[model samples]
Target: MNNRFKAVLFGVLLVYGLMLSASFILALFVRFDWISTQSLDWLPFLISLTIMLLGGGLSGFRSSEKGWLSGVLVGVIYTVMIMLYQFLAHDVWLHDGQWLHFITFLLASISGGIIGVQLNQRND
Candidate 1:
């Protein structure tokens, strides 16, 4: 409801839109034989990391303090949303193998938040 939370949500939505666009493009490429599907096996993980990083950065920029905490919260929320969607759509659940992806996302988001806070401070 607050400005910071709103910014985080906006960032998440923005990333999701970008991901959807990318997926569509990839699908087209695959359909046309321009790229092999096997090459895109890592796309989902990369997209997830990117989304969390951008979302956390936005949150940190808008928040008054506790940038790391804000980043962590954003990362967790994003992951949960993604997992829930996957579960509902594909009946998939998290497995032990996915822990690395989650950790990577969290770390990337925290790093982004730190950068955002630093940038905001510099601009002030």
Candidate 2:
């Protein structure tokens, strides 16, 4: 209910929403045969970065100095959600596609954390 908590929640929700959208769009493209669905994991990576930006921007707007943690937290949440969704939809684990999400999430978290930290310090 406080500003800090609100900002963190907002960032996580924003990233999760964007990541879901990206996954859905990727599914569409794959279904249409426009692109190889096998590479759909790329969607999460790119979208995660976008979400990181959103998270960083929100944290910056809130004038909070907790950018890196917020970004990393958001990334981790998004990754967990994505993995859950994948499991529910495919009912499978240990697939190539699954690994993509895992790897991308890891990278996104690091990059997003750094970005968030930098952004938090920008106006200081």
Candidate 3:
């Protein structure tokens, strides 16, 4: 397999893994009344930003060049996966504010990818 492809694959997987773990933990917290659901309204946004950034960073680190491209690929793939999931599971074709979220997430990932490249360069 190509190194770049491996990088993107791992990045996506890492994001999904983190999301699963986070969901489980949050579910536990909610189930046990450790946190109020009302107060966790920002949870999705936070998680999306954080996970995408991490994934983009990983992709950039592994690719070792063209960080922005890596970030864009990761963001697009992630968004497509999400759309597929919603369509298959919930029978939903579209959602409000999708573009806003996509743009924000993409920018966050791009920023992270650039940072990751800088870090890699510094280490080299």
Candidate 4:
């Protein structure tokens, strides 16, 4: 497969993997009452932002070109995957202000891609 495609796929997978890991940890914490249930409110957005950046960085480093585009692809694919899963599994539509998530995630990934490219260049 092409490096760009591979990068994008890997990036999406990485995001999902990290998300699952985060969810599992959160569940454990909640089960133990170590963190209040209210903590679930804004934690997901923060987790997504950081995880997307890491995923985008991996894609940018692997693709080594058009890092912004790779990041965008990663963000889009990841979002679509979630949407599809929710639609198919839960039969749920998006609630209000969900578009903001897409925009925020895309921007985070883009920034990460740019940083990753610079880092890759420095390592070369």
Candidate 5:
């Protein structure tokens, strides 16, 4: 696959994987409300970092010009996935805290994409 395609796929899968894992962890610890973090706060940041580093490393097609687009794409895809899940599960719901979740996700995705592209260029 071309590097751009690989970069896009990596961004999508990395964000998806991290989000799902974070959701699972939240569900697992919902009863205790561990550290008062029942909301999905950490997921987006973590996913963005993972995707930025891993995706760039793997694809080796990083460019500052594409960072914004890539980041936005990842954020949009992740949000849509979350929305779909909320739709599918009748009991599942996003509280007001979810606003923070989406915001963080967008910020993290954008930052990560920028950093990734910068690193890729530097390395080259």
Candidate 6:
């Protein structure tokens, strides 16, 4: 595979790993009563932002052109992967308001890609 593809894959994996780690830590905290679910309701959004930003940035860094497009592709891939997993594992379907979150993820990713491309240009 090309370097850009490899970078996007790496970014996705990195995001997934970080998310898994975060989930484990959150579970531990909840089990120990160190945190409550109600208070941490925003965690998912935060995690999603991080995932898109990191993934998009990596993609943009490696992409030869159209960094925003690359970022959008990465975001879409990640969203589809997560949705598919949820469907397969829990039979869950997309509910109301979820689309907004998805849009936010896409926008965040695009912004990250822009920044990454600019940074790469600067470095060169």
Candidate 2's displacement at residue 54, Å, is: 3.7
Q: Between prediction 3 and prediction 5, which has the larger lDDT?
A: 3
Highest-scoring model, lDDT: 4
| Tens digit per residue, CA lDDT, model 5, 17-108 | 65567667666776576745545576545655564444433323353457766776667667777777897876576777877767766666
Q: Return the TM-score for each candidate structure.
A: 0.81, 0.59, 0.94, 0.95, 0.63, 0.88
Scored against the true structure, residue 3 in model 3 reaches a CA lDDT of 77
- State residue 27's C-alpha deviation in candidate 1, in Å: 1.9
Over 16-60, each residue of candidate 2 has an lDDT whose tens digit, in order, gives 677678778877888899988577655555665666667545643
Compare candidates 2 and 6 on lDDT and give the better one: 6
Q: Candidate 3's residue-wise lDDT over 1-124, tens digit each?
A: 9877887888888888988898999999999999989989888789989999999999888888888888888888888888899899999977898878988888878876777777889899
Off by over 4 Å in 5: 1-5, 21-64, 91-93
Candidate 6 residue runs with Cα over 4 Å from true position: none
Better of 2 and 3 by TM-score: 3
lDDT tens readout by residue for model 6, 6-116: 767766776677778878888899999999888888986897698778778877877746778778877888789878988899998787888888889888888777777
TM-score of 3: 0.94
Alpha carbon lDDT of each predicted model: 0.76, 0.63, 0.86, 0.87, 0.63, 0.80
Clashing pairs in 2: none
Candidate 2 TM-score versus the reference? 0.59
Residue 72, candidate 1: Cα error in Å is 1.4
Task: State residue 90's C-alpha deviation in candidate 3, in Å.
Answer: 0.6
Q: Rank the candidates by TM-score, best first.
A: 4, 3, 6, 1, 5, 2
Q: Cα lDDT for residue 26, model 5?
A: 61
Q: Write the per-residue lDDT of candidate 1 for residues 1-124, one digit (tens) a residue.
A: 8867776666566656766777788789999999998898887678767767777777777774667877787777767887998899989888787777878888887877777777778889
